[model samples]
Target: MASPKSAAIAALRRQLMMGDGLSPSPAPQVTRLGIAAIDAVLPWGGLPGGAIHEVTGPENDGAATGFCTTLLARLSAGTRPVLWVTAHDDLYAPGLAAFGLSPERLIVVRARRAAETFWTIEEALRCRSLAAVLGEVRGPSRTVARRLQLVARSSGVTAVLLRHDEDDAFANAITRWHVVSARRDDAAEDDSDARWRVDLVRCRGRIHGEEGYVARWFVEWRAATGDFGVVADLRDRPDRPAPARMAR
Candidate 1:
């Protein structure tokens, strides 16, 4: 009962999905952050899947790792395992559990050199069964980054790069984030919450006039519920009160 034009369109869509035609494969869907305000500004309404994202922090600061772990927890909510590649063996499994990432759901790969680390990351990204891949590299060249981005897109897997210090811009990355620990004046001795100043330094496909799309938020990760709560959005006026906590 389908019309000729309609049926033709449907067949073309099928081919596209199956990667049978000349057109490139469809871009992976977006993954929402579960925060309305944050999602609203992004081009895809959230983090784009099948792309590379970068997170960086100051030396000896665990803020970047913590933030990346939070993202891994969200992405690996399903049964698929996540691959984490690093050159060092300093990762604490128990600490990761605080961020909702369990040892059983993670596979750690220790590479002896930076080249090996990137190789492992690319291989992991090619595996369709993995929920995501995280690589701890100081600074990857633009060529290496582009290669990873293409592989991730083709395999439909998310790739995250964790760095201890600032590096040159990665042109192929979908987003770049900077995180730093934030101090709370009023705090309890037993508080296990993690507070950070998260900055969205660069996001592709963002439209905010000529001012460039940069945003900052003071956020806290609740250890009990494994949720992220926004303390404040610095983009707003200082006098304005912070918004209510975002529901997961």
Candidate 2:
């Protein structure tokens, strides 16, 4: 059954394919949320680069805007522009400032309903300049989420969808989280060490930190990964040992 010439050609073809194009590859770069413990816990050091990260919660609990603002602040602090597409309009501007975000850096879009909000999110995710794109949306069809997943894969930025309701949204997301303000550890001197509990209800790959609950804060970060639970005042993080130099 074996012809010498045919066998030789087949072997050559296999070698060419293997040498030039048959090698498989994973995601280009998978960086974490850049939060200390969070990145440490994630498999690729972060959520898959182009993956949908679901933030689900009850009504407006500051969980939606708050998490997005802080995550973006961390990113922008590292030199990335954030695009926030929300239905809240101007009501969210001052709140964003409280999280150390410059409204100027935010590209805010007003969506009338949940569906429109998701549409805008997918479009911006396709853009290269944005560091992260956050959208306040509710349960989206599985097809839409899968499509968004593709856009996320192509763009390194995280596509964070704030699911307004938990029932369907949580069920369908690759990763779903319910964020709430955890009790403040005021036993310490300063109160700026506010912490929130990020509950990772579901994630496709390995994630670090405790799943039931994880503590994080409003403090300035010196390192890409800080002790999220250490209760250190923003003033004390070693990265910025000196008193904060606030800009006017």
Candidate 3:
């Protein structure tokens, strides 16, 4: 039998999912990444919608952009537009079509300085009509990160911060991921399908002691299927024995 207090809490959670009683309907409780390997490890069974997530990659590596854009496609899979704020205008719009993000639904904001970038991101996050807001900055202070996290939580907007290769400042985001490009196992020359080696360097609510306990995966985005999935398990690859390093 369910205890009274437990049942009430469950009821409240259900109501929140339905966007009634306490939370607004515009924001869903969670946005499943749709990748089983990654989603299963997340505390919420998916990326927390109304929170901030940070992604970084090696300097000049194109993998980070690919991974983030694919993620944004999943995060903003609705009628609401996605806001992308950055100081640079190097993002190629046509490349995004392959990732399922239409250029029409993406609103780009060019900021002249880092402060302007963060300010614009903060303001965009507060808008309920936006499905997600992505900010590209070189570095941000911990204080600014905290402010962004708090605002995302309050407004129920998914926030993504993309850091350049050299910028590795600490942040208060729920999850911090490091991405790098990986070659396909088949050794194909074409770039039709892309692979990535992703590392979860920090997760806010990760279990203690197990902070070091981790596993890495080779994630792939299949253009044919339009989804992301684990292409190879780094720990145990089909072509090789148990290895400490990924088959990059």
Against the reference, the lDDT scores of all candidates come to 0.75, 0.59, 0.73
Superior by TM-score: candidate 2 or candidate 3: 3
Query: 1 or 2: which has the higher lDDT?
Result: 1
RMSD of 1: 6.9
Worst 10 residues of 1 by lDDT: 239-248
Can you list the residue pairs that collide in candidate 2? 32-46, 36-225, 41-208, 50-152
Residues 187-232 of candidate 2 have per-residue lDDT tens digits of 5653443465565555544232432322233333222233234345
TM-score of each: 0.80, 0.66, 0.78
Predicted candidate 3 versus true structure: per-residue lDDT over 1-248, tens digit per residue: 89999899766655543331112445446778888877777655787788778888875888888878877888888556899997778888888877888878899999999899999999998998898999987778878877887788788888888887555545566677888887676546544477788777665444322333234568877788777777655444434421232111
| TM-score winner | 1
- Model 1: per-residue lDDT, tens digit, 1-248? 89999899766654543341111447466777766666776655777678888888886889999988878877887467999997788899999988878878999999989899999999999998998999998788878887898788788899989988575767677688888988754536535377888777776543222323256677777778877777664444234332322111
Model 2: lowest-lDDT 10 consecutive positions? 239-248
Candidate 1 structure, TM-score to reference: 0.80
Q: What's the residue-level lDDT of 95 in candidate 3?
A: 87
Least well predicted 10-residue stretch by lDDT in candidate 3:
239-248
